[model samples]
Target: MISITNLSYYLGSRALYENASLHIKPNQKIGLIGLNGTGKSTLLRIINGEYQADGGTISKAGDVTLGFLNQDLLSYQTDDSILSVAMQAFARQNELQRQIDELLHEMETNYRDELVDKLGKVQEEFDALDGYTVQARAEEILEGLGFSTDDLQRPLRTFSGGWRMRVMLAKLLLQKPSLLMLDEPTNHLDLPSIQWVEKYIQTYEGAVIVVSHDREFLDNVIDVTVEVAGAKLNYYPGNYSFYLEEKALRNEIQKGAYENQQAKIRQTERFIERFKAKATKAKQAQSRVKQLARMELVDAVIDETARVNFKFQFSTQPGRHILHLDDITKAYGPKRILTRADIRLERGDKVALIGANGRGKSTLLRIISGSEPVNEGKRQLGHNVSFSFYAQHQLESLSVEDTLLDELKHANPTKSEGELRGVLGCFLFSNDEVFKKIKVLSGGEKSRVALAKVLLSQANFLLLDEPTNHLDMQSVNILIQALEQYEGTYVVVSHDRYFVSQIANKIWYIEDEQIKEYPGTYDEYEWWMEERKEQEGNSKSVDRKPAPAPQPATTTPRASDDERKEWQRTLKKLTQQAEESETKISQLEERKKRLEAELADPATYGDSKLMQAKNDEYHRVKAEISQLQDEWENAMLEAEEWEKKLA
Candidate 1:
């Protein structure tokens, strides 16, 4: 556990925190939420001892281990493979194992007394720490984070930045420190991998502190929320949903108190002015003045809302067919990302592309937008289809020296200077901010400027990749609203489930070197996924044969009730068998329903192989159901015969 008391920090002339106090409990999942520039990352650094607080007392319980994921650190080199990098977390254990091996080798050669004693102590220490399973644990963590068995042996340098982040995450998970701190940990993760991380954190026994813009991830993983505002920190018990409700109630109370105090101040001033003109009321006026001076003034809380807003204006409607891709095959050397792929997009379609990291979601997007070439495919754009592309790496392409206003103006040459400034103002850049160089802008500011420029292009079809990365919750919601209202085509690749659910009308899922489409919201997609998992579990369970029925003894019954007793026994056995058969049949039927729904998803329509596989599964289950029914009928017939004998 860690406690921060009366902590104060400053960044240049701005006060980041003033006397902020917070207590982090053991095994608590905490979410740090606040507007940009409110010191969320700075606070994390202070906890990790990377940054020293100007004035504060930080206390930690004895010998607590801490691991902090630094987003900006590129210390991991290319020469190291993913497996080796993850295994580095167990360096101490590995060293102990090596020492024990050496000691054993020495004993076999000469049976040295000193070497034997050293090995005993080393073995004791290793056993106490469960050091024997270190390699297995590391591999488990790596695979859970979506690293393929083949990828584990590949050098880290060959991986992209996003893949490198996964390696870092795997190391942290394997280290199993007492406290874990992550800033935007989900940024580099795809949906499936993100789900895997969520499940891992839920089962983690240590405390977790994450600063992220991902609403759904926080909601699923965290139990408490901490908001940094007014140069102080406030804690909210429960998840993000609970925090939102609590914040609203607190804001209402603060607003009422602020208004009441202002009213009282105005009343006192008016009474003093009226009485000061008359000598007889001079004493009364003086008393009133003292009363005003004694009154406690309430300082108004600063507004913490993000002012950036994006609005798209449509110029004209596109043709029926928006885009068409035929036999698209792209690869890098031996690794084929997309192979023999075909897709067609119609106007007014809102689609979400999803897949594991490095599965060509972005590559496919680039090929459609004409930003990247396809190895063997034809990309055709329908008549009157105007497109605006928002690349995930757009930040790198921006000029740091260009002013925000100048950038917007350059993108839209026909727009007047006044029009450009107005657009920037809507995105929270005003007055001196518009004149500031883009190079000096924060990540969030840069994102807003990029989006602003994209909006001005007047393109009907938009392709956005991770558009919500640097945006706060408020800004994200605004963007979602704008995208929902736009009367055009949209193909977005994002990990934010809530945002995708809100705006997308269809989903494109890439798996096993193929792309599939689903026509529905994210909620529907989730339901279908759960059903598929249930069906798989049922199939595995049903592979074994049913247990044999217990046989009745052939010995004669007691003379007083021989016939009745025999009949009763036979009926009981038959009834029990029928009941068991019915239960199994019901379970299989439920599983079959789920499998049918999964097969119905639009994304699966294009894959003939998967469709055939699903169909075959359906038939297999149907045959099983028929067999179960026949068994049930036979059991019922046996029960009827026993009942007649008893009668």
Candidate 2:
């Protein structure tokens, strides 16, 4: 519905995009991805008209509307309830409602035929928009995004940045814009909320362009991947996983082509150099130089993948047991987070703490790190154990005035500046980037710096809460590699399933205010959970009471002659209805097949009117087919019931 052609945008003098063109088609699910500094979010802003492109054109159909959900919305707050905020999406409907109310008041004060007519028109329009159910729609979306029913009436200002972001997301989803552009939406959502959004986006009628670092979420929701690289938008026909494979193959081919081109250039240059001074071959050498000048150079493939190579070390090795908690009871005001909960951690344990939001995952992390106080219980640390806790709030704790180099030094005074720079380099802060002040760093940059500090702390045990929050896919991979190589015990809370799956061997979740463990990988845990759900479903569906034995029928009275004839007539009519319904269904199915073929034709795409007509008719035909099928089934069912009665 929207076309971005020859789009060029700049940051200072550096070109973020040059001649980058991307066509967003109707109902297309697109994953916009790249490294941290790439302009994924900027592209969205350009499309939403918040930022102007330096050059080129962005065209949208008159019918297309846009809704954008970005991190900047985290600062949006009001005393109004969240439901009220989300319901604001229905501007037209709300106006119509107001008009209806005014007209009704005017009728009570001074009745007029014109007033009645206007009221009727406004009410009709409101009903046409399904205005009455807008509140329910808002609530459904808010709850789907992890808000409770009671929380809907809570003021938006009461929520944290992440929760407020969810409110904005709910508002956008409620708007149902023709093209939805989301920037790192999954960063603010929990696992359940993420999955809910995935399902919703899969069925959404509009086009979607999502910028996210969550690999699993991208794969689940998007059908296309667009990579921003080399000042160009590269399109992939499939999801993130497919993009990875395809990019690898393309890189290999590019590398080969580049090498061949370089060799050819070297050979041509050598021939020119050797023959240029000779009288007989001078003309030929000049011609060769012209040919070299005309030759198109194949650009070399640059591998930008960041790697973590630093080993995690501690001054003292802890005993087998790292941490233990017993009968822990914790509460915030009247809301009890954990009651009589107990958990244990051993050395070398890699645990992924996960669950829906407000389930005490972070609270439990704080408790384990001894940062949170418990109402009743005992927490003990093993011998020689040292720990570092990394949380989102820690990003704020960073010294904004210090350079990245200085920050790492503060984390560990013993580590030299060179050693700290090496650590920062592994986190993708290299060369002059280490000299950048912490205040100038982006969210992902700040996160990397904080993580580097955690690493420099040389702690034997780590409590990491949502460490992947601001990280891009590559940064997350770096953290994964670091954790994979570490021998320390750590419990990390994350909603990014792919990140958790790669690094965690054990799954931990809070249930009934108690910490529960699944001693397996993430995939295994998922499979087991699905199986458990199925088992529970089957148990609920199981017939609790043994079915009574079939009783034999004994009939003494025969139907009267009139009654018998009436019964026969009813059965015959039912049979005829069934046959007629079947015929209609067959005809509709045939019609549906023809429409599908026409819609699939390439020529249809060339004509917008024809394409729209076919699409509308396609849905109409499908709905008709479904209705006819249902009627046919009902007819057959009635015929069967009649037969049973006669028997």
Candidate 3:
């Protein structure tokens, strides 16, 4: 367990945290969330002892270990094999193993009783630590993170930066420290790798604090959320979804209190002004003035909901056929990236391109955008189909000397100053913030600014590469909403499952030098994945089964046309029942909400009649809701069976 008390940190004149206090319980999984530059990573660094806090204390239990995986720490060259680097996590255990080996050799020749005893002690320590299984564990983690069997032997230098980051993640996961601190752990992961990491974290015994922009990942993996905002920390009891609702309620309460205090202050000032010179009311006026002096004015916190809205409007509509890639073949020297790939994009199509790191997802995006040429194949862009491309390494393309506002203006030369400012404000940059130099901005800020510039380009077809990399949950959500409403076509390469779930209408999975399309929402894709796994398990079990005795084949059950029609009718009835039960559940939820609101009123707090009535209503609604849910589930199962039989 770790405890932070009265913590305060500052960078020059900017305060990151002031009197921040947080307590992390043992084995608790926490999600750290905040706006850009709110010190989520800095706080992690302070906890890891890599950076010292300006004030206050951080206390940890005896011999507590901490592991941190940040973007800056993963700047390793690719020349090192991924497995070799992952195995470094067991350095301490390896050292102990070496000591054990030396003692064994010494005892084997000398046969001294004292030497043999020391050797036994060393071997026992090694066995207790599971040192022998270190290599196997390391390999398993690396493979789960998307490194192929052949990739284990490939030098790290041959891998891309994203793949190198995956290697670093594998190393950290294998380390298994008492406390794991991960910032954007899902950034470099593909869907499958992300799923693997989620399963691993769920089963991990140690505590975890992850800072991620992916809302679904946090909701699935973390039990608590620690929100950093306005130079303070707020803790929520449940996951990100619960945190969002709780924070909204807290903000509503704060705003109400602030308004009430302001009203009181205004009333006191008016009373003093009106009665200042009146002889009969002079005492009252003076008393009002004193009261005003004694009153501690409430400082209104900025409302996050009031942030600028981003709505991209483009006058020109793209051609019905946006892009066509025919027999595209790409290679880097001897290694082929894509082989005989054919893809078509139509107007208003929102597609997500997903694959493991170094699988050429970005390469395909570039090929379609015409930024890179295919080694073999023809790519055609539809007439009047203007495209805006956002690269993962877009920072290198930006001018460091330009201010954020200037960059936007340069990108949209036709836009007026007001229009440019409005666009920047949508991305959370406003007023003086727009004047900050691009070089001075944080990575997340630069990402936002880059995205704002792209949105302002007025392109009907957008190609984005890892656009959510450095964004926080709030910014990502805003982007998702904007993209959802945009009429333009989108081809994005992202590892953020939540973002993909929100915006992507189709998923193009790239694997083994090919792309496969899954036409559905993310939930459908997940269901298909689970079904495939179950099928594979069943197949394996069948393979292990003994041979069956030969017997005469019996007639298979064949329903007549009338029987099949009756089965279909039953299936329809079951489906209707399921839907009706779900509707009842929704109605109960609405009643429960109303009952809770009434129970929260102060007038009903101590009234025995009101309390009993509200409690009864609450229990009744809950019981109905539970019963409806059960009925819905059973109805669904019956409907599924009926449908299968009909099929």
How many backbone clashes does every candidate have?
Answer: 5, 0, 5
Give TM per candidate. 0.79, 0.82, 0.78
Best by lDDT: 2
Mind giving the per-residue lDDT tens digits that candidate 3 earns over 140-253?
888888888888988988877778888888888888899999988887788779889999999999999999888889999999999998788888999989988998888788
Please give the range of 10 consecutive residues that has the lowest summed lDDT in model 3: 311-320
Q: What lDDT score is found at residue 331 in candidate 2?
A: 93
Point to the candidate with the largest TM-score: 2
lDDT of 2 by residue, 1-647 (tens): 78899999999999999999999999999999998888999999999999999999999999999999988899998999999999999999989989998899889989999999998899889999999999999999999999999999999999999999999999899999999999999888999999999999999999999999999999999999999998899999999999999999999999999999999999999999999999999999999999998998888997766455886668555655678898899999999988898888877899999999999998888888888899999998865589999998889999999999888888899787888888988888889889999999998999999998997798999889999988988888888888988889999999999999998999999988888999999999999999999999999998788879989998769778888778778999987886776677667667877887898899997899999999999899778766765665566568768776676
Stretches off by above 4 angstroms in model 2 are 108-113, 545-647
User: Candidate 1 vs candidate 2: which has greater lDDT?
Assistant: 2
The lDDT for every candidate, in the order shown, is 0.84, 0.90, 0.84
Residue clash pairs of candidate 1: 78-157, 516-603, 517-602, 517-603, 518-603
Model 1 error, position 209 (Å): 0.9
Q: Looking at model 2, report the run of 10 residues with the lowest lDDT sum.
A: 628-637
lDDT of 1 by residue, 1-647 (tens): 89999999999878899999999999999999987778999999999888999998889999788998867744567697788889889878888988998888878878977887898999999998789888788788888888888888899898877788889988988998899999888888888888999999998999999988888999999999999987899999988889988888888788889899999889989989999989999899999999988987776755444344445665444545688787788998898988888788888899999777778888888888898887897998864578988875797777888988788887778788888887777666778888989889888888888887887888889999899987877667767766876788989999999889899989998766667888888889889989999999998988778879989879755445876787788889888987787787777777787778868977665788888888888889878877876777678668868776665
